[model samples]
Target chain A: QQPVQSPQAVILREGEDAVINCSSSKALYSVHWYRQKHGEAPVFLMILLKGGEQKGHDKISASFNEKKQQSSLYLTASQLSYSGTYFCGTEIRAAGNKLTFGGGTRVLVKP
Target chain B: SAVISQKPSRDICQRGTSLTIQCQVDSQVTMMFWYRQQPGQSLTLIATANQGSEATYESGFVIDKFPISRPNLTFSTLTVSNMSPEDSSIYLCSVGTGPTTGELFFGEGSRLTVL
Candidate 1:
């Protein structure tokens, strides 16, 4: 099943902060975050395992809640380079080697 | 991490023609996957390419329409058969390091414009 992403789009100014949430109805073994610029392929950001852990990249961090079957990505002190569409891909418990991606959240950071 | 390369970054083809997109990985991988993303839409899995065997197509996708070939661990190709306007989309190839975490690395993508 496809994950659900909240706040389809968000605009932030430089040095601002924002959060993108992804929720799945089914139990998730792992949640992966990716970013894609307009007309470009998606780039891998981080992956959260089933253990309900958090991963960080620079000012970007993501946390997965195993009990809630949800994940949240936090962008702190956002920069202009953070402008892109973010997608959360979920790996269901019984779905091996298959990932269902969320609709996506478009983030625009302006200076 | 794997370095993935795709050919024909963008192409314009006629309706009746077929186009084959190629994916190459720097390191050997166990499985490679194909995905399609329509304009302003989320990525959808097309199939899983297995080395020396037939590829598995996802729901709403068929092997006859999108034939795949995984000749080896480092290379795979997805051919769009009998293209149409609806087939105009960005096709991406990805490879997971293993089956455990479902973490994957993706290629830049090949954009096809069917006329």
Candidate 2:
């Protein structure tokens, strides 16, 4: 099943913060985050395994709650380069390596 | 980490024609995957290209419509056959180390616009 992403769209001023959430109805083995600008392919960001680990890159970080079957991506002190569509791809343990991506959340950052 | 590239970044084609998109990886990979992203939509897996054998397509996709060729570990091609406006999408090829993390690296993608 496809994952659900919250806050369809968001706009923030530079140096602000925002959070995008992804939830799945089924248990997820891992959750992967990716960002894509207009006219480009999605870029890999980070992955959260089943152990409920939190991963960070630069000012971007994410937390996965195994029991809740959800994950949250935190963008702190957002920069202009942070503007893009963010997608959460879920991997189920029984489904091999295939990923089912969420609808995505469009984020815009104003200077 | 793998460096991937796709040909024909964007193309406009007539209906009923076919377009073949090529994907090349800098290093050999055990698996390569093809995905379709329709306008304003999330990525959808089309198939898993296995070298030296038939491709494993997803539920809604078939080999006749989206033929895939994985001649080697580092290269593959996805051909959109009998194209129509509905077939227009961004086709991406991805490769990963393995199924453990489910982490994949994607190409720039080949954009197709059928009219």
Query: What TM-score, over all chains together, does every model reach?
Result: 0.95, 0.96
Q: Count the backbone clashes (under 3 Å) in each candidate.
A: 0, 0
Global lDDT of each model?
Answer: 0.92, 0.92
lDDT of 2 by residue, B37-60 (tens): 998889999999999999999899
Q: Give the range where candidate 1 chain A is weakest over 10 consecutive residues by summed lDDT.
A: A91-100
Docking class of 2: medium
Which parts of model 2 have CA positions greater than 4 angstroms off? A94-96
Tell the DockQ for candidate 2: 0.64
Query: Against the true two-chain complex, what DockQ does each candidate achieve?
Result: 0.62, 0.64
Query: What are the runs in model 1 whose C-alpha is more than 4 Å off?
Result: A94-97
